[model samples]
Target: MVKGALLAMGVLGAGMLPAFGPCLAAGLPDTPLDRARVLLVVQELEITLLTHPSATLALEAWCATHHMADRPVVVARKMTLPPADPVPGRVRADLGASATQPIRHRQVQLVCGTHVLSVADNWYVPDRLTAQMNAALDGTDAAFGHVVAPLHFSRDRLEFARLWSPWPGGGQGAGGMITPPAAIVRQRAVLRDTHGRPFSEVVETYTDQTLAFMPAVDADYAH
Candidate 1:
């Protein structure tokens, strides 16, 4: 669990962003103030992810700054056998790869201590990476963003979906406590090299634990 004050990251009283996603209904908080904290933290994190070229580096900063853990975020392999997702024609097009070109698929939990910040799926063209990079990815727990850092990649946002929010429509007449659900947001983006050639496509789902740093809605609001 996250431990520390949110003073370093700050908070918001108003300006709730409307959450949009099919799963929003499943992730709503109880009260208006509870919802406010969720929206505030989610908004800040969304912006944090965009400020850096490498998501791994960006998340490491977030983890440390928020005191989510004693150590920085690390990629934890979520399965014993790698997931076998069927590659689609459109996926190949999105990745700028010809049909039959080799693609590496990895599923991982981006964890800070015991808290999982994001669950990610990466489909990358291994041919574009250095041999050492491929070896590290195949053998170690190095994050996809860090492993390919030498490419000087840029993430091109393709989709930003909010899975939950406490806004104009959700958690309105609430009597429940502020308990955040699992995931708050999801994103799909393509990673491109220095020359702007697409090499990887990823989907990242950020969890409610990102809000774990914030104090309880009732406690903070009471003061």
Candidate 2:
């Protein structure tokens, strides 16, 4: 599990922020205080994820930051495995012919205690994985990261998408407490073995549980 403070990277490139900058700019409350809060929240999210080696590691660190370090398990639920579908054009291009290597597709939810932090879909090249790694993946709910821990895999982030709240052009009124944007942030990346051969492609979605754990901001922050 991750420990101590995070070391964030510069992943959010130019324009992604201003283009989707604080919803306050859209005029909900529209105060300096509200805008600062939104920016702070977005920065926190960026830092938290940017520094982590992988979403799995990020979630583990988040659990530690949130004081759930006592429980070691981070993957709460490993839902049924679905037959791998035709790889996306981008993923196909990323992995090349290796993309056709027998795929093992799985969906899993990472949690800290009872709070589900993120849900992810991992499509991995089974032949690229060791026999032992494949066995663990097939027999248990262990996270792909954990299952392949022995391989000392490293991840390369390829893309990031911030899904805004209330579905493009939705309501923005204050309802209850300081409402943080009910948005989801997604990261798409490939995991490689120690030799740097890409073995898996994963897409992880940070869920509402993330906002619930952090300082709340405007509901329309990214609407």
Candidate 3:
């Protein structure tokens, strides 16, 4: 129902807001603070997403940097709700699907250790993939990008929406305590193999769990 509610909200873009009393880095002094660590987290996430080709891998880096978890990212095939919107016709056409060709839908949460960093909705052409690739996708919890890596796929971006940006909001908070959203950013793209054939279309919704960690802060960083 929660996913349904999000979908019914017209277009699912980015985030929701909550207080930051519990997210502060341990042993950091903030007496003279003019900014919040959450601000830094947002900026870091933005730049990482912009520069990285694979959000799944980029998030693995983030998890390692933040020490949020000790393991590589994994996909949890836990999203049971049908996508709020039907696969757009344009997506089918992009994958070169004929009227009779079959397209498959998959949705899963990308989890790192304990936190769910993001949820992804994917529509892919089964015929474009190898039998092993399709089987791995259907049976394993492996991230889509990882499973399809053998194809040497590259992302073809369609759009990016930064639903919550600290700079845009001035990073101002009540008493300098910011409340960040559950979702911070979203992206839509297609995956093209080495031959430049589109095989999958994905829509990813990044959650605040991406910001769930104590960033490495130098002693003088806040000064």
Candidate 4:
């Protein structure tokens, strides 16, 4: 399960904390380190949904009912050739669904350098995680406006510093002498809504460790 994978990555936490000061000041929820992790999970769910036959059928039925079968959507994948070949490639899927025989999946082949990649048997995905992902996608879309505020606040509070540097600048001065200075960098959080609006905002400060959140959002109130 995706939740299990997240748990393995240490995303859940002990309890809910109070919302104080600025939204960014509140700190991240005991969740993954950043939005990237969430996005990867979302992508995986989307792939699963797209590949599952049952899920495809459902989406096809919906598309047909809505009369939106002619729309063209694009999907992509990266590919690498065997060591002996040294070629690179990609695969792209163009899909359209409708009320009648909705869900037409196509495969395209790409060749680059000395490599080739192929995509085939376009289908629907119907996993439990896909349903959860759909819900999360919906929630993200509904809360699009408010999400950025907290992310920005968090970045201001968390910072990191580098420990090592070369002394006297250029080429290790005088008998390999080295100097180190305390360098500070801040942690930033980013998120994206369903419409694909990139939210590059900082929300809170964090230690070099894992955090988690319990019931991160109230599903009843999300919509």
Best by TM-score: 3
Return the TM-score for candidate 2, rounded to 2 decimals.
0.69
Model 3, residue pairs in steric clash: 15-183, 16-181
Q: Each prediction's Cα lDDT score?
A: 0.67, 0.60, 0.68, 0.22
lDDT of 2: 0.60
The candidate with the higher lDDT, 1 or 2, is 1
Better of 2 and 3 by lDDT: 3
Model 1 pairs whose backbones collide: none
What candidate 1 gets wrong by more than 4 Å, as runs, is: 1-29, 78-84, 169-175, 216-223
For model 2, how does the per-residue alpha-carbon lDDT over 128-217 read when each residue is reduced to its tens digit?
888888888888878777787877878788887776443323334464223334345778788888898888877776665654433324
Residue-by-residue lDDT tens digits, candidate 3, 68-112: 777766555545655544555776776788766788878777888
Kindly indicate the candidate among 1 and 4 with the higher TM-score. 1
In angstroms, how far off is 20's CA in candidate 3?
14
Task: Measure candidate 1: CA RMSD.
Answer: 9.6
> In model 4, how large is the Cα lDDT of residue 160?
24
The better-scoring model by TM-score among 2 and 3 is 3
Candidates ranked, most accurate by TM-score first? 3, 1, 2, 4
Q: What are the per-residue Cα lDDT tens digits for candidate 1 across 58-107?
A: 78888887776787766665434324455555558889898889987776
Q: Give one digit per residue, the lDDT tens place, for model 4 in 1-223.
A: 0111100112211111222112220232222232333233224333433342222232233333323335311212222222442101110111121223222111121111111111111122112113454353234322211212322211111122221212123222233322111111112222223443332221111111111110132222234
Q: What's the residue-level lDDT of 221 in candidate 2? A: 46
Instruction: State, as a TM-score between 0 and 1, how close model 1 is to the true structure.
Output: 0.78
Residue 218 local lDDT, model 3: 39
Report the CA-based lDDT of candidate 3 relative to the real structure.
0.68
User: Which residue pairs does candidate 2 place in steric collision?
Assistant: 23-221
The residue ranges of model 2 lying beyond 4 angstroms of the native Cα positions read 1-35, 68-72, 81-84, 98-100, 165-183, 215-223
